[model samples]
Target: MAMAVQGSRHSDFFVEGEVYCDTCRAGFVTNVTTAIQGARVRLECRHYMSASGSVERSAEGTTDATGHYRMELVEVDNRGAELVCAVALLSSPVPECHEMEVGRDRAPVTLVQDVGLATMVRRANPLGFLQTMLARYADTDTRYVDTKMRHL
Candidate 1:
């Protein structure tokens, strides 16, 4: 099933990154990597707090093999933020698992290479959101960004 991307294509601005095991700092490498699959990878961009309490969220998603996943950030004015990108392995195909949080400064970023942890989260899309925005911004007729494309 094709998901409706506001633009003709999803871009590099779409964030995503890698995942690693705490004990083994390698890619979730090996055949028995079941524990790392289906993990929740989240990235939150908190600006300097709005007058209201609406702290902005940059993106969020889950991880697949190659130990990778992606998330899209939806914002108007691009001001960087303190980002918290995290991964949590859930339910016992393994056993008691806790969440791990990796914080870093984020601009219009696409990838977060491996930090010290076993896994990492990066901007999933290779083209990024702005590329899609351009399609909308350059619209000769209709606005495309918010337009919903059919899947079937």
Candidate 2:
């Protein structure tokens, strides 16, 4: 006789992501990203048929020393509908990197039960901020005038 193993009925799902400071001002997060500590992030969810038509639920968390954050979400029951979820950057504790970068502020994730995974874990893309310092140009003493003569 073969015995069947049953999975736990109650489980928790999680959303994980990282926040970084774009030190190079490259407008994107690269391998050499500097992780920001104490950065605030938020997770929002919305149901399609809500009366107010706004976000149904929201949760917030802060980044650790490594600029990583994880937020726990209630296990979803995908009986016949879907829920839309998104993770967004709230604020950065670093004064210089506090401004949110456009197009890199939020990331969307889907939470469904029929994915065949024992545990649900979603990862959002790295969000970043632009550099605060302005560009500098060097002054040169050498100067040239435009010559009127043209060679044929």
Residue 100, model 2: lDDT of: 78
lDDT of 2 by residue, 1-152 (tens): 12322234334568899889887667787775699999999988888667776876677989999999998876456621456778998988888777677688889876776666665787888888665543111122222111211211
Model 2: residues with Cα > 4 Å off, grouped in runs: 1-11, 49-51, 79-81, 116-118, 135-152
- What candidate 1 gets wrong by more than 4 Å, as runs, is 1-12, 24-35, 49-54, 80-152
Minimal lDDT window, size 10, model 2: 143-152
Tens digits of per-residue lDDT, candidate 1, 49-130, equal 5555354654456667645666665442324433332322222111222323222112244233333333332433211011
Top model number, lDDT: 2
Total residue pair clashes for candidate 2: 0
Give lDDT: candidate 2, residue 37: 92
lDDT of each: 0.38, 0.73
Span of 10 residues, lowest total lDDT, candidate 1? 125-134
